[model samples]
Target: MAAKTDDSGPVLPPAIEYAWGLRDRPPKGPRPGMSVPAIVDAAVGVADADGLAAVSMSRVAKELGAATMALYRYVGSKDELLALMVDAGYGPSPGPPPPGTDWRAGLTRWAWAEHDVLRQRFWLLHVPITGPPITPQQLGWMEDGLRCLDGTALTEGEKMSTLLLLTGYVRNEATLASQIAEGSRATGAKPSEMMPAYGRLLAQLIDPARFPALQRVLAAGVLSQDDDPDDEFTFGLDRILDGVDALIGRRAAT
Candidate 1:
């Protein structure tokens, strides 16, 4: 589908146009086994099996048994393909919270849905964020997130900012979790073992006098072992929502 663009319309990349169904597919007889969605699916598969690093255009093309140049015919470039791959990888949003749900509960659900998606496809955390969400699926997620704040006293900008803040928190938490898990795999250390090992190492290196606060934490065995990932996730999510709750309360009062 060709994009609805006029003489003064904003220029979008070819892959993005295809994603929006705004760009036509190959005109040369449908290209028999090649399409934007096919190409993106292939790339996502490559990332899933290997990793984001394994998802080169040539690799995706090889998987499809098509020439590397053939991929370019559908997706303008590797960056374009990566963008499309991320859009497809997200699949779709969990959708807005059920009707009549409180805003906090809706946002809580939205945040968890995103957390679940990233955890399942941790490779997505590795993709560089060159810009904000604009692709179809990405925008859909954004819409759902924003919808959670609808009918609140907050203004549009505040709503957008709240989503941004919440999404950022979710991504940061997911990224850290992914890194720790990767570290465990690389070192052959189980999740439960790594934190305790680190605590021991810190206990040896840190002087109680020089690092009293850290020493107190160490003494309390706070890092005795890894915390349940879900527990950690819930704690952070609740705190962020608490701040949002306060903001909403203030807005409503005024």
Candidate 2:
């Protein structure tokens, strides 16, 4: 068969080239004993069972019944493997919204879909973001998010900024949920138990008369029980979308 060409030129990122089946297999080396899918699946399993800390190359190798160094034949480094693992976890872009859907609604659905993925694979929040995402799945999500604003009057820069803002909010919300779960696991105490102890510590450190605002927040029970996590996420997403809508309206008027 004739080698395929990406006639669009060097448009895709390097990692994406691998993802899109553009890279040819090495002709000289022994066939790789470990497949990329196997390695990624093993890594994900380890992470899901014991967290990301347990997903070392050696550990993954053991899971796959391969020699430790054999994994390197398929994946260049642990970092590269991690990138692939994240992309695998991301899966495919969701189906686009039906025609004439409002931009806000499209973006909201996109953000919530991403939030659901992160929530399910909570380790994703803890995976250190080393640099820009280069994986195909990640790029697919980026493309989908950008497409959400296609009918809007926003400039390319504005669209990009809005996507970044939404991504940051989703990541932050996921991190908060992960942290709360971790805290509960470590302390063996419910939020109610921990909240009172935290409040008492704060009371010892700050007099209510001196810090009225802080006092009021404490009294209002903001940090008491663990609030419904979904409610928290919805509240933040609504506020952000409201801000974006306000900006769009201003631009429309001017």
Candidate 3:
């Protein structure tokens, strides 16, 4: 697809235009076996099998059994392909809860849905986000997430901001969760074993006199034990939801 530009500036990159179906195939009839979706699939496969580092244009082309130049006919560049791959990897968001679902439950489901997507496609965490959602699938996820706050007292802008806050929290949590998974695989140790090792390493290296607050935490004996693996994520998400609930309460009061 051709890139869209205006007196203001470029609205959609060529790849995004192709993704959103704003434009058709690039000129000269893109190669017979070459399509944007095919190229992105090849790239995502490479990323999933190895990592982001394995997802160069040439690598994806090799994975597709096409010449590297052939991919350029559709994708434009590696960065463009990365953007397309990210949106494709996310696919579509699930439908929101049935009518009459409370805003808090709906929002919690939205956050967890985002979490699950990222968790499954851990490589997506490594994809750099350049801007807000504009790709069709990305916008679909955004639309579904916004529905969680529908019929609320919050203004449209506030609803959008709240989604940003919650989605950001989900992504941040996903990154850490992915790292922990990777560490466990590398070390052959479970999450429970890893935390205490980390705590012990900290206890030995951290000077209590120099770091009183950390010392206090260590003294509490919390890190030395194997807590629930999901305790941290659960606690953080609950706190964030509580804060959002309080905001809604205040808005309703006013």
Estimate the TM-score of every prediction.
Answer: 0.93, 0.84, 0.87
Residue ranges of candidate 2 with Cα displaced over 4 Å:
1-16, 24-33, 191-206, 221-224
lDDT of 1 by residue, 1-254 (tens): 12345699967777786667885653132358788788888999999999899999889988888888888777777878878888888988999889899999999999999999999899999888877667998999999999999899999999999999999999999999899889989999898898889999999999999999999999898988788889999999999999999999999999
Worst 10 residues of 2 by lDDT: 25-34
TM-score, model 3 to reference:
0.87
For candidate 2, list the clashing residue pairs, or say none: none
Q: Report the Cα RMSD per candidate.
A: 2.7, 4.8, 2.8
Give the RMSD in angstroms, all C-alphas superposed, for model 3.
2.8
Q: All candidates' lDDT scores?
A: 0.86, 0.80, 0.81
Residue 239, candidate 3: alpha-carbon lDDT: 96
Off by over 4 Å in 1: 1-7, 24-30
- Candidate 3 lDDT, 1-254, residue by residue in tens: 22457999877766677677777664233567677778888888888889888889888878888888977777778878878888889988877767989888888887888888988889998987766667778888888888989988888998999989988888998898889888999989987788788789899999988999989988998789877745676788889889888888899999
CA lDDT for candidate 3: 0.81
> Sort by lDDT, best first: what order?
1, 3, 2
Of the two candidates 1 and 2, the one with more favorable TM-score, higher being better, is 1
- Model 3: runs farther than 4 Å from truth? 1-4, 8-11, 24-30, 184-189, 202-216
Question: Model 2, range 33-107, lDDT digits (tens) per residue?
Answer: 557777788999999899998889999989988788877777767877788888888888775765887889999
